[model samples]
Structures are given as structure tokens and as C-alpha cells.
Target: MSIQDTVDEMAPLRPENRHGTDPLMVLNGIRQEFPSSRGRTVHALDGVTLTVERGETLGIVGESGCGKSTLARAALLLRRPTSGEVFFDGKDALSMRGGALRSHRKRAQMVFQDPNDSLDPRYRVQRSVAEPLRAAGVSRADAAERAMAALAQVGVPEDAAWRHPHEFSGGQRQRIAIARAIATEPELVVLDEPTSALDVSIQAQILNLLLELQERQQLTYMFISHNLAVIRHLSHRVAVMYLGRIVEVGPAADVLANPLHPYTTALISAVPEPEATKRERIVLTGDLPSPASRPTGCAFASRCWLATEQCRTEAPPLTTTAMSEPGSGHLVACHRPAEAQEALASGLQLTA
Candidate 1:
């Protein structure tokens, strides 16, 4: 099926239907904490809740330390969360052990940021691609056959399969990594900054390859990246994170075009525009708060241009606003969402 076909098939599942229908993945109130050297706990993730429907792409965007990667790892159960529930295809993923966990691992896969780091230089490309199949108990001969087929599918030459990862360029190695990811025919793929390391031209090629693979396999993607443009290009929905919390989430177009949270607005504004168009930029001040010493109220209040007394004292819950369409699920956590929305609508330049 084509991407559009998969989208159309799953179109009936609106954000409102997320809880009602069976989703590919569900993370409810996930929180990850680590003990800092200073004897305090760092909140890597704070109350992150999200759902990924089958055959849809959910793009996660945030600054470097905003817990996007932590959320991804928690979803995949790589790093168990300090608290929360993880449901994969309606099953309790966190509670599974041994055989059940192994079975679940086959259904979900991850493609890391750097292909060079992910692929073993000591092994042949084919061996690396077939590792998952071999781990699943497939015979060596069958795994080799599947590996070559997968390599060919990703535009890697069949003859090059026996070569080491160092033999190929960065983009080619990424193709090999992608081939390995889909070789198992996983239903969900968590891509953690998969294309960020490549040049712009190669990034486009990899993105196209990913979209094509998703279409052919009907795969669901949890794509994590700092690039808003890329997230807008490939995501059906977008989640914006700040300081271990999701500040805003909604349909990709709606969230990017009409951001409702101060953080989201600032993030979107930072996206490079055409040279001819003059757009107001929201330049935020103050460094990101240390996770171990996070503010008691809104994590972003210290740097938010629209912050009020309420923002400084009271934590805002992720609330669905009237600005959101009934099924669009546009939610924002802010004490002054209206002011933020108004600032964007009025094209006011904000420096805080």
C-alpha cells in the first residue's frame, strides 16, 4: 500500500479515538528520574503521555536536553521509566519478561542517530543486517537470504553485503542501518535523529527512503529530532517538548502554523525562513533550568515572554483549548495560552 492509502485506511482514528481504539503504542504519564552526583534526582521525563496509532508517524521535537531521546528509550523499554505504564499493541510491555519481551522486541525496532556507531565495523554489512533475524532463531541460510533482499530494497548493492561498514559512505551506511531495521518487518520504529548526521542532500534521500519503506510495510514511526522542518515534512502529528515536559502537541500543520504555547511559538519562530520574508523572532533568555533543580511551577516560566504571576507559582496541566478542532487534539500546557496565541497572531516580536 502507498503512504496515502495507509493514511486513508487509518483516517477514522482521530486523537479523540486514541483511547478507544487499539494503538500501536501508548505511554501514560511516563517519568524517568536519575540520581545526580549532587544527591538530587534529575527528572529526565516528567509526565509524558502519548499514543501512536498504527501506520502513522508521530514526530517528537525539542531542544537537546528536552527528554526527547529519553522518551524514545522509555517507549522502547531500553531504559525502564521511573514511573508510568507502557502499552504496546494493548499488551503491558513493562510487565513482560523473558520470552514475551523477546517477542515484543521483534515487533518494535530502533534506528539510532549515527549509522557508523550503530553498525559494527568488524562485521560484514550482511551480518549486521541479519543480526536481528539470527537472534530470533532464523537459520543462517535464511537470514542471509533475507538480509541480501533487505539490502537490495534499501538501494544497497547485493554484492556489497559482504563488505564491512567502513567501505561505504555515511549515507550508504545509514541505508544499511535502515535495511537492518526493517529486515525484521517491525510494526513500530523509533527513529532517534536518524537523519541529523547526514548532509542536506543525503538527508532528503534518507527521508524519502524512510517514507517509501513506511508505505510498503505499513510501519508506525516515532521520529525524534531537533529539526522542526524535518518533523513538519514527515510527521502526521507533532509533539513539542521542553524541560522534560510536552508543552504542546497537535496535528503537524496546525501546531507548526499556529503554535499555542510560548515555547512552541519560540521553537517554530526559530525555523529559518526565506530571505525575502521578514518574520518576527522570539529570542528567549536565561539558560535551560537544570533538571535536578527544576522550577516548582512551569519549567519555562523563567524564560517565557508571556509569563505571569500564575505561571511562576502554579503548574499548568496539559489542557485542550478552544483553538483546537474537536478531533485535532491540539493541547498546550501554559497559564497564558491566549497571550501566546495572540502574540503569534499579531506578529509581535518577543525578547525575554
Candidate 2:
């Protein structure tokens, strides 16, 4: 069957698939690809599998074009996957129709980056936040009331609600974006680099605000970013993506402290430390390979220091290694797992 047919078959709002013990959101072998000329395809996401526990923050970090946003869109069901399944609260996430889909919409919302563009410039903050509720059948007066509450929840002053988006600073505008996202009291909010465009100080404020809101509202998050330090602070677990595939995933502390994949290690090493005396950077060679024609064995093999002949000929599946698993699961895709570990320990400086 075609990808669209597969999507149509999965029922995202069924009760049977919604009662998992741990996960509130699950992505099973999800894949997304865009067709290219010459009978090729750009593999944006390849067989990604992960889960989000209720009220947990899961950070997804990767280089640009590694499908971070695409993954987020898949979870939101905004961008249908080319293959695989999404289970939310035990139901197929791709099959809901009409009211079911509409109800589910309130359950999952997205906080986009760039408040300036995300919020309609012409719409006042009150109307912008009220838009979702209005769409869900809320009365105009009631929607306005809910919009004000949402604004307060995100730290916006009451007076600002009547003002246009341009009336506020970038940080306040982002808070407005957050208000719109939470107006419906969504259980899961896919945060797509919500703070990346803000100033450093503002980023911290937004992060703290998100954490506070999550705790207060018991919200689950799929936080996507390229910033390791931000991920370390916000995530309960971290999944590292490279070339559209997750090469390493585990508890945030464990994966950040001892990254398993070569790409992950290189990424972690690039994070600047406060103590200059203790810092040693690992610079990988070459630019990120294009997704249209990925490497045969490992997508990361071209830039991987420990890659061998086997790595070039056989693809590695996401699997557990013998080193030691973190409390939450930590998985890696590499033929020479030990060698990857040795490279991490030796602080091997990658060469071109």
C-alpha cells in the first residue's frame, strides 16, 4: 500500500492503543523521505523509534537537516510519516477523522520557533491565543477569557493581551506563542526550538518557564534542538540523531556524560565548557553527507573515525551495547561498539 494508504489505516484515537503503562506517545520505525530526481530520495528520517513517557521531557538533538523538525511534525501528525506507526495513548495516531481528530488536536499542540512569524503580526495577542480555542467551538467571549488566562500562565501581562504581537519584545512574543500552544491545555506540546531565536538570557528564562509550566500542568514534551547544553538542562532523556537516524539514545545525564555514537561524541565535545582548562574539542572531518545518497553501511561512516570495512558494507540497527545501559534505555547503532567507546575515552581528535 502507499504511504498515504498506510496513514489512513492507522486509527490514532482508538482506546485499545491508548493505555500503555509507560508511554504517552510512541513512534515505531517511523520513516519520512522526499523524492528527488534520478530516481533517488532524500531520507529525512529512517526507522526512528522512541517513546515519550507521560509528563516527561524528551530532547531530540541533531545537526541541521537531520530531521529533528520532521520527527516532531510526525508526532504531531502534522506531517504524515512515509512509513511506520504512531501510537498515542494506545491508539493509532494516524487514523482519527472529524471530531476525533479535532479532539485529538487539543491533546497535541506545537510551540514553534520565531515568535515574530509564528504569531500573526496583524492579530492582537488576545485573538492569537484565542484562535485555537475559537476553532474548537469556544464562544468569542469565553475564548477571550481563556486567552487572557493562557497569557498569564506564560507570564504575559494582562494589558499586553489587547496589544499587537509587535508591541512586545521577542521574549514576550515567544511567551505569547507558548500561551497559544497551551490555551487548549494540551497533554503533549512539541517544542520545536522554541528558544533558539531568543537572546542567551531570554533562552534561560524561557527554559525555566517551560519547566515550571510542565510541572504545574503535568505536560509531556518532545523538545527538539541542536544545543546540547539546553538539552542537558531540559530533557529527562536525550536521543541523538545523525543523518536522519538516531545513533544514540539514553538518559540525558548518561548520554551527555558518555555519548556512545561517534557523531554524538563529536557533538558533545563541541559543547563549550565553563572551565577552559578541562576542555578538549573533537572536530569531525567533512560536512554532513547529503541524505539523497546516504553512505551504504552506516550513514555516519563517512565522518565516523571508528568506521571499518564491515561498517561500510553492513548497516547497523539500533541495538543495545555491552558497555552498560542507563536507567532509561540507551541504544546505539555501530558495528564496533567497543571501538566507539575507546575513541570517546581517548578523546580522539577527528581528522580529515
Measured by lDDT, the strongest candidate is: 1
- Highest-TM-score candidate: 1
| Model 2: residue 305 alpha-carbon error in angstroms | 0.9
lDDT score of residue 313 within candidate 2: 87
Please provide, for model 2 over 178-259, each residue's C-alpha lDDT reduced to its tens digit, 9 standing for 90 to 100.
9999999999999999999999999989999999999899899999999988887888778999888988887665677666
Off by over 4 Å in 1: 1-22, 274-278
Candidate 1 lDDT tens digits, 213-276 = 9888888999999999899778878899999999998777667777789898888777776563
Whole-model Cα lDDT of every candidate shown, in order: 0.86, 0.84
